[model samples]
Target: MSIEIFDGIFRYGAMTLLLLICVFLLRSHRSIWPGRLGASAALCTAAYLGCTVAEQDWVILLLLPACIANSVFVWMFGLSLLKERFRPGWPHWGLMVLILTTGLWRKFFADADQMIPVVLEWAHQFIIMGMALHLLWVAWSGRANDLIEARRRFRLYFIAFTPVTMIAIAVIDLWLTPDVAPYFLMALQSFSIWVFAMVILLQAVQLVPEVLFFPAVVLEKNLPNVVSAVDQIAARDLATLNAWIEARDGFFETGLTIRNLGDTIGIPEHRLRRLINSEIGFRNFNDFLNHHRIEEAQKRLLDPTLARLPILTIAMDLGYGSIGPFNRAFLERAGQTPSRFRLQMPPGSS
Candidate 1:
């Protein structure tokens, strides 16, 4: 029933400060859009903290204003990250305004004696859960950007702490009498401080230092970008051998050596070797050979016309030495056993 004697001002203030710093770091990448969302998140955090520290009735009025601004800003920031082509219009603004208005009403003037801030609490929960869900979707759907990656990493670091705090809150609310000091709340606050410290420590290793860490940073920043750069090299005019094309296109039956491929493509053997090893992101020639060959094997296995053929025949057709490695490669690429895939093929299919 009574506020704890310990001031929570420092905790909330520290969180607000850290979030604003993140927002500043994030704003450097505007086209990413999620960066702006992250900045808005920082603003909301600061607003929440400001509300927590307010002392007067006049100061308390600022809480609702802060909540309303944060709700609209956080929601718009979330929508911006969904990759839709069309910009949100008036209806979006109306819905956000409506949500913010209801939140403000609930927080500031719902009933005499401030009956309960139910709408405000629920709206805040909705925002937190919605943001978490969005990050989960981006992680699984392969649309994860750097901002999403940062959020995901932070979520992973802190998820284990949530249930302990929630259970503490619930137990206090239910079984414990109000007169009992909220000791568990203090414990939860301490626990969060530790979690925040751990998160910063872990994240520091991944951050790119502008001058010293550029090479490793570039690789870590985005795998797709590295893949794209290699693809560009492949597209350019290298004196590629006709044999290399044949090897890539499934022409070589046996004795498909790197030297032979280089001879056929007119590129020097060492150059061809380095291109595959360094640029193409594969370690060695055999692994490179298997990748393309397995790609062809996958197509054959999926083809209704080819499905009924003996698995061994498919293996031999793709230049594999035997059915065992062929099936392994197929399963690795397609995520299922070749036999299972064959059985699932439609009636009258290969």
Candidate 2:
């Protein structure tokens, strides 16, 4: 088959599949961000396909807008990882405007300047790749903090999809020569989109009970055996878990260490560490203690009877040697200092 014929077939086929995925996203009741992004991506893909099939010089102008759409798709995924409802702020708008301006200048003003277009395209691809990688890192690192099952699953899907798509595109753009058949690149792009679409479909299927009764079963299949083994340990150590929970309030002891606590509780320090880290989902010993201390502090801070008590007094009472550590921990968890939190609380709150 001729390269042009293959490219046409692949592009059209990909566009059709992308359109269906866009429609499915739009129909879903879930967050609209993904749908909007998918739609924009689909539109850009269609435009690029049109340009390729038509063999028109004017189609080169479409590259800039397509790049912007792709960037927005990546930006939206990043925002989804950080917040439930993300409105594009000044930085995002400024970056998009700057990219669009540069692309326009290259297409219109850089007459016969092959170097400028090449440079701009290279810069654009690198920026997109960097942003996608950063978002994937954020998703991977923040997964433990995400308590909502659906949102966590969505983040996982994005984490899995973004790096592969970005790396593949980077390789194709950097290494592929003009002499190479366009269908090869088209096929690679289509396959990546197909995989992403499949991920979304699987996520949607999780919403339907008949299609898959237990979504976690599928997720567990993908996870390492270490996680399940840890879960088993967490389940089996019920006595230690209960003892730790009952004695968690003692965590406020000044200069308390895991070894000292383990000695007092008659559990091995290493086992206690595992129980706290694996069972309780805390990554650090300090964080585990901080969580309990901060909870108690919050109660006292908002207590109507204790409203007149000084913040430092409460901090010291919570086993914190000084107010500074307590204040920082409270602020980290509550997004405000103890005094501010007390002031904001409704009067007469118990």
Residue 349 error, candidate 2, Å = 15
lDDT of 1 by residue, 1-350 (tens): 22343335445544655464455536453444445554554455456445544567676575656545654554454444333221446965676676677666665567735536654555545554554455445434422212233343434433344333333433443344334536545434434543543343233234522211111111221221233234655534132432344445534365466666666656666566556544544433554555567667666767887766888888787777777877766675567887787676667774
> In candidate 1, which residue pairs get closer than 3 Å at backbone N, Cα or C atoms, i.e. clash?
240-265, 241-264, 241-265, 241-266, 242-264, 242-265, 304-350, 307-350, 308-350
| TM-score per candidate | 0.41, 0.56
- lDDT at 309, model 2: 85
Let me know the TM-score candidate 2 reaches against the reference structure: 0.56
CA shift at 2, candidate 1, in angstroms?
16
Provide C-alpha RMSD values for all models, in order: 13.5, 9.0
For candidate 1, the 10 contiguous residues with the lowest summed lDDT are 210-219
List ranges where model 2 is wrong by over 4 Å. 1-6, 30-32, 48-67, 78-89, 111-118, 143-161, 174-183, 205-350
lDDT of 2 at 347: 61
